[model samples]
Every structure is written in structure tokens, then in C-alpha cells.
Target: MQIAKVRGTVVSTQKDPSLRGTKLLLLQLLDEEGHTLPEYEVAADSVGAGVDEWVLISRSGHAACRVQGNEDRPLDAVVVAIIDTIYLEKRQIYNKREQYR
Candidate 1:
């Protein structure tokens, strides 16, 4: 999973049948500090994420296509979770001990 920020919403009047009713969002990839990455993408929102929310993105083809219980969506990326917070150790976010320390 990669961290991303919701930048905007996608409004598609016509799309693939598998994508019907799915919420597409414009995501700007984010660093640990929530800074927007240079590149951005549009992702399917199965978890009801909102703009400005820090989210966990699932970029796996299988996982993204598994939305609505169908493994055939045209989706190449999707939002899987809304991150409440992420703990980091040093420059890497590998430790949660600081939360207790």
C-alpha cells in the first residue's frame, strides 16, 4: 500500500459497467509528512474516502479489481483505507514504539 492524499473527485457520466456506482477520486501521492508527490493518479474509492484525507492506496490489479466482489474492474488503483496516523522510527516509518515512549 502507498500513502496518498485526496486532491479532487472524478465525475464520469459514462464508464464501464463494472465501474458504475464506484467513486473515482484524484489522488496525489503523499510522503510521510503528507506532502504531495510530483505525480498523481485517479483511483477507485471503495472505502468512502474524502478530499484532503490521507489514505492507503491499493495498487494491486487483483485487489483493485476485487471491488464489488468482482475481479474484473478496469481499475488499476483503489483506496483501501483512511490512515488515522502513521508512526515512524528515524527516517523510516517502521516503529510504533514512539507512540508508547
Candidate 2:
């Protein structure tokens, strides 16, 4: 599991049957300091997430489990949660937020 900001979205005209009808988004990977990292990749969205939205991303098989409570979503990255509020008290910590943006 990792926290990343949704940088952009991706659309696939042709994909595997398992991944059909799934929405994919390009995520701008973030480090602990909330700084954007150069490494970026696309993720499939189970929860509706938009661009520039801070979202919780699950990778590989873990991502498949988050959706439908079963490991069959055929996804490498899924938007399991969206951040609403982030409060860092110098040490960098998540405080409170639940808008699911």
C-alpha cells in the first residue's frame, strides 16, 4: 500500500478481458515529505478519483484485494481511499480528512 497523488488519467482502447471497463489513472508517486517524485505510473481505479486528487493506492495483488473484498479486480493499482485533510505537525503525519475527492 502507498499514498500517491492522482496526477492524470489513462484510457485504454484495448486491454485484457480482465481489465475491461476499469478506469486507469496516472499517479504521481509521492514521498513522505509530500513532494512529487519523478517516477510515475498508471493505476486502475475502482473508486472514482479525479486528477490532482490525493488517493490511497494499492499495488500488485494487494490492489486486487481491495476491490470487492476479493482478489479478482485484475488491477495493479486501485484507488482504495481518497484523502480529505492532511495535517503534519513538523514530523509529517496524517490528521483528518474524509471527502473521498
Candidate 3:
């Protein structure tokens, strides 16, 4: 699993049948410092993660397929969890509970 920030969403009029009702989100990869890298990914949402939320992303095709319960679907990434907070030692670095509210 990897960490990413939900930057926006993706809407497609025509998609594979397996991904018909799946929510596609744009995600920016984040390093340990919470800084976004240059790479971005379009991931299928499994945990109902929204924009600006920190999410745990699975980049494995098998994992993504398992999340959607469709083995035939072609998926490289999927949002597995919506993070609430990140604690580095005794310091609270990133917290979404306060940001969302």
C-alpha cells in the first residue's frame, strides 16, 4: 500500500463494464513528508474517499481487482482507506479530522 492525496475526480462517459459504477479519483503520490511527487494516478475508489483526503492506495492489479470483486477488470490502483491522522513519533503531522471539519 502507498499514500496518496485525493486531488480531484474523473468522470468518463464510456468505460469498461466492470468499472461502470466505480468512482474514479485523481490522486497525487505523497512521500513521507506529505509532499506530493510529480507522479499522479487515477484510482478507483473503494472506501468512498473524497477530494483533499489522504488515502491509502493499493497499486497491485490483484488487490484492485479484489476490492471491486471483479477479476476481469483492468485496474492498477484503488483507494483502500481514508486516513484520519499521521503520527511521526510523538508529533502529529497530518490530520484530516480537523481539516474536513
Candidate 4:
């Protein structure tokens, strides 16, 4: 798993049949300090993560397919959780409540 930020939504009218109705999100990978990295990914949203939210991402296609309803879909990544807080070196770096407010 990896940490990333949901940067935006990805809309596709034409895609594999198994992918229909799945919410796709554009994610920017985050560094250990919570800063955005240059790498970007499009992931199936299994956790209903919204834009700007820090999320836990499963980057394995096999793991993504194991998520409920994502079975057999050609997914390379999936949003598995919406992060509520992040602490590093005893310092709080992110708090969802405070960040959204």
C-alpha cells in the first residue's frame, strides 16, 4: 500500500464492461512528508475518497481485484481507505477534520 492524495475524478464513457459504474480517481503519490510527488496514478475508488483527501492506495492489480465489486476488473490500483490523520516522528502532520475546516 501507498499514500496519495485524490487530485481529481477520472471519467470514462468507454471502458471495459467490468469497469462500468466504478468511480475512478486521479491520485498524486505523496512523499513521506505528505508532499506530492511527480508520479500520478488513476485508481478505482473502493472507499469513496473525494478530491483533496489523503488516501491509502493499493497498487497491486491482484489486490485491487480482490476488493468487493472490483473482482475481475482490470485495475492496477485502488483507493482502499480515506486517511483521518497522519503522524510522523511524534509530530502530527495531517488531520482530516482540521484540514477540511
Best by lDDT: 4
TM-score of each: 0.80, 0.74, 0.88, 0.95
Give me candidate 4's TM-score against the actual structure: 0.95
Better of 1 and 2 by lDDT: 1
Off by over 4 Å in 2: 69-71, 89-101
**Candidate 1 ranges beyond 4 A from true positions:** 90-101
Worst 10 residues of 1 by lDDT: 91-100
Which of candidates 1 and 4 is the stronger one according to lDDT? Answer: 4
Q: Rate the local accuracy (lDDT) of all candidates.
A: 0.78, 0.71, 0.85, 0.91
lDDT of 3 by residue, 1-101 (tens): 87899999999988788777778899999987688889889988878887888998989888887874656779988888998888888988788878767
lDDT of 4 by residue, 1-101 (tens): 88899999889898899999999999999987898899999999977888899999989989998999988899999999999999999999899999989
Model 2, residue pairs in steric clash: 85-97
Best candidate (score: TM-score)? 4
**Per-residue lDDT of 76 in model 2:** 63
* Residue pairs clashing, model 4: none
Q: CA lDDT of 53 in candidate 3?
A: 88
* lDDT against true structure, model 4: 0.91
